[model samples]
Target chain A: MKVILVGFGVIGKGVVKVIDKKKNHLKSKYGLDLKIVAICDRSGAAIDENGLDLKTALKVKEETGKISNYPEKGKNMSIVDVIKTVDADAIVEATPTNIETGEPAKTHMIEAFKNGKHVITANKGPLALYFNELTSYAEKYNKIFRYEASVGGAMPIINLAKETLAGNEITEIKGILNGTTNYILTKMEKEKLDFDTVLKEAQELGIAETNPHQDISGLDTAAKIVILANSIMNKNVSIKDVKLEGITRITPEALTMANKSGYTIKLIGEVSENKLEVGPKLIPIDDPMNVKGSLNVAMLNTDLAKEVVVVGRGAGDIETSSAILSDIISVYLRTKNE
Target chain B: MKNNKKQKYNNFNKTLYYYGENMITLDLELKDIPGELIRALTPISNMGVNIFSVIHLREKKTDGRVPVRVVISDAGNRLNEVINKLEEMDIIITKVNETTRKTDIDIVVVGHVVDTDVRDTIDRLNKYGLVVDLDLSMPDPFKESSARMKVIIETDKLDDLCKELDKISEEKNLLFIKSF
Candidate 1:
């Protein structure tokens, strides 16, 4: 699969590193001859008519903060132009999520679909807001749309629900969906500290963003719920459909009280036929959904087999990019089948 | 099998697998009454679905019920029949997790749900082929209970789910509030 990766931020770099590490393995094991035709960042896009030397491109990106310094770079073309003109089989949209507008990434995905290119996105905005439209576009153009990294990072919740548990009907999906809030909650629970104190530590550790409204206010989890509801359980719902609550109101006293009651307070996103909500809830201490630290866990409730829970890191560069790579392989195999 | 050192560097873990062609996990909420959990799992065992693992949260209590998570794989093609039997037994088969290309709609059913027998209403809705998943909150067995449910049905069947909700409201004398 010849690819063009847009948004050369942390996830983009992570994708480059994972592809480089798994280059030979993918070809040998999966029969996927993966190649990168172009790479783009916020500032500019870099193109190589043939495959680009990603290692050298990574070195340049690390040193100069731009891939335009690559040996065969075009003069900073727009991402749209690169997506339109690049002779590639897939586009990896790794841009930061913008739920408000679904922005440049949404337009980029639309452009990719218009050009009959498969898409793998880490951005949640487009999927949360316009899942039906984008999915329909992919079908109309006969392109594969995969966004494993959008929810659960390396946990593979999307793929697990989509592929592993294939026949049983999914009734509900409950998850410790966001790592930042979970981190804050864990710290508050273990250290008996308040939300602000733990949040400051999280910000310093680079787990929570400087402007941490989305992560703290439960919007990020809401976005993930929307994507999961639409992609897996097949609901045409959006963030607005979720009854949102954050951990900001949770106090150390409350945590201590919950502990006394044999429960742990964690932000849980519950998705079912009649309910979509993300808020701090009291999960039993031994419950699988009560995973600690930055780990993410999703418990899928089904009719036939019962309940299955998957747990893994919900963030980090390599972890999330691993999801993008899986989506890439899915597209590769699907394309081969076609 | 690869060595641990080599596996450590391999970032991608292959999870896109179907234990066979059909694997599912059920999230069930059984009435705290004795034998309810047994009643739920008996048909599953009888149908010969490969039991992967079962996690029964006996200590966790919600809505005066015990939440159990059962993982099973069906290669013999009898999983649906097992579910149908469970439903007929009024075992409160709370959630059926399977893979489908259907939209999931979540809503909240508030007030006196358990008194109206939510299981019967769900079974009635199932008659229309609208798959339903419930997370109920009936903290006190003697009082009113609300539920959060995810309805997995085709896009065209959304109206059907809504109409069913309306019917459930009228018949059960409850308020159905769709989560925004």
Candidate 2:
């Protein structure tokens, strides 16, 4: 399978490393030989018709800070240009999310579908805003679109609900989808520190971004839930439809009070029939949803199965890349016969 | 066949019937003090209700109260009477059968809890639910103070209580962190 990587950030670099590490395993286990035809960054794109050397691509990105610096195969080309002219079977869109306007990534996926190529992205912006529009384009062009890594990082959700639990009617989806907020809240409760103090410590440790507005303000979780609602539950909703409430006002005294009542506070994003909300919900201390630290946990309420809970690390370059790689192989197996 | 008999017990001399074969459960919250458990169960016994099992949820004891689940048989039509008698004795009945009749909701209010007329805030919330327990901490009067309150309300009125909290939040510039 020939693939194009649309972003060369941390996640993109991880994708290259994973593909290189799993090259032999993929060939031996599934008889699948994958190749990277193009890797695009802000500077330009690195293209190779036959296949790009995975090591050299990473080295160019690390040393020169741009994939376009690859020996002689690199060129100054736009992502759209590469997607439209590149001869590839699929394009892994790992661009950074723009929640306000699902731009760039949105256009990238649309162009990939129009140019007769499959798309496997970990981008949440386009899916949150233009989910139906993007999916329609994929369907209109008769292409396969997969984005399992968009939500819950390495934790399997979109595919697990839509595939493994196929027969059960998924009634609702709820969990701690963001790891940064979970980390801050956990540290606050454990250390008896104020929200600002704990958040500062987290930002120093790189668990939180310098500008952690999206993660702490519940916008990130809202976007991810919107995707799950639209794709897995077949609901036509966007981020605006979510009733959002962040954990800005939570205090250590509040956690103590909640502990007295056998409960803990978590930024829970819940989507169900006639309800789409993201806020600090009281989870029973011993409940499956009360996972500590920077771990993400989700509970899918199904009609037949009753309830299913999945817990995993919600962030990390390689952890998220693991999900993207799985989607890549899935696309391969599905379209291999064709 | 069993005979239904009228019995007079206690100082009130209220006529109670010892009859029927219905089994029911009462989730009662008792003060963590001596004789409170026996005091809660005596009312049902006075109504000629036979006690089946009493399970003490010791692990769930919070705020100086212990939850006791009492199962009784032979109450039948006297179930309401037993509930009324318990209420008359100031015993908190949290649930009847598997249905939650009353629930305790804990909320942490941040902002000028005392400056914004905390009494009025409690009074307004009391319209929908009883604000039974309150704990306030003010690290500095110039800064926002946080208050934790436990409101015992009927399960059906939860939505109304939340709506009231939102209204209070908007009116007084207070943030209510609620446990639902």
Candidate 3:
């Protein structure tokens, strides 16, 4: 499987590492010889018609923090150029998310589809912003558009909904879709500390991002819920439609009060056909959704399967990349079946 | 509600097996010896038969021997080997019952379907067999409402499923009426 990997960020590097580590295993187990044909980053592009040396490319990126220093590095070649010109089976889009515009990643996805290439994106921006349009484009071209890593990292929730739970109608989706806030909440509950103290600790521990507005304000969860609503629930909803509420108002006193009532405050994203919302709701402490640390849990309410709860690590380079790799394998299997 | 730490089902039940191999219950008589029960189970486990329940009917024993009932599920034909091994150990092989009987039944559950946790109700029904379809009517859920559910289950355990539904209905103070 020849792949055009766009973005040499943490997730991109993680995919390269996985492909390299699982080279023989993928071939022996699944009969898939995944190779990186083109690697494009913000700095420059690395192109090899046959297959680029992934190990050296990764080492170069690590040392120089650039893909342009890689062997046979191509200049003046845009991400769109690689998607259009590179001879590959799929495009792995692992760019940082820009929920506002869905940006260059969205444009790259459109171009990949236009060029008759399959797409596997970890960027939630494009999907959360224009899921219908992009999915239609992929379907129009009869190509696969997989983004399992978009919502729940390595949890494989999207595939679970689309495949495993296919026999049943998913009535609603509720989950903890952000890790930073969850860490804060867990800390607040455990130590009985205020939100600001927990937030500072999380920042120090590198759990929360430096600019934590997206996470603390619940916008990140809103984007994820929008994606789930659009993709799984088949709802034409956007972030604008979701009633967003952050954990900023949750105080130690309130958390303790809720705790006394056998409940814990968790930032939850819920999606139904007609409704989409992300807010700090008081869930029973015994509920599986009330997990500790940065663990993410998603519960899908279905008619047949009942309430199928999926818990997973929602972030990390390797974890998120695992989801992307699974998507790649899914595309490969689909193409093989076709 | 969304807080993100992600994990998935490590031991996912393979629903595909339900179609090929049927669930079964085994009844055997074994001597009241330390290794006798263990010896009888070696063959069953080796054959990859999933044991559902193992009931040692000690009170119903006769002449230093006890009747043991084992409920297993598998698609493979390995019961002969199991019986042969039990016979070698001087254990009696009483019966081997397969749960392949199929039955389709429709049920109407009344009163506050959503407020009473309809998802839990559907999930409970699905544990028996396949919940074929469901039609819910809740014009106003705050008031009384109902759901018409269709289920295709193994005929042998139809009564068990009904009893479970009855318990749920009684506990929730709802009406569970099975329609022919």
Write down the lDDT of every candidate, Cα atoms only. Answer: 0.80, 0.91, 0.81
Worst 10 residues of 2 chain A by lDDT: A253-262
Stretches of candidate 1 off by over 4 Å are B1-180
Q: What is the TM-score of each candidate against the true structure?
A: 0.67, 0.91, 0.66
lDDT string, candidate 2, A1-338, tens digits: 99999999989999999999999999999889999999999999999988999999999999999888999999999999999999999999998999999989999999999999999999999999999999999999999999999999999999999899999999999999999999999999999999999999999999999999999999999999999999989999999989888999888877877777677899999999967989887778899999999999999999999999999999999999999999999999999999
TM for candidate 1 is 0.67
Give me the runs in candidate 3 sitting further than 4 Å from their true place.
B1-180
State the displacement of the C-alpha of residue A126, model 3, in Å, after optimal TM-score superposition.
0.9
DockQ, every prediction = 0.03, 0.35, 0.01
Which candidate, 2 or 3, would have the higher DockQ against the true structure? 2
* CA error at residue A184 for candidate 2, angstroms: 1.8
Q: Per-residue alpha-carbon lDDT of model 3 for A1-338, expressed as tens digits?
A: 89999998989999999888888988999999888999999987999878899889989899988888886565557888889988988999988899899998999999999999999989999888999999999999988999999998988799999998998899999999999999998998889787888899889989998999999999999999999888888888788898776877665655654554346678899987655778777676677888888989999999998999999999999999899988999899889756
Best by lDDT: 2
Clashing pairs in model 2, backbone N/Cα/C closer than 3 A? none
Candidate 1 per-residue lDDT over residues B1-180, each given as its tens digit: 478766755532322354445568776667678877777777777777677778887765543557777888863457668767876885555566754324434445556777788779778767654544566665577655656554545555666766786678778876554422
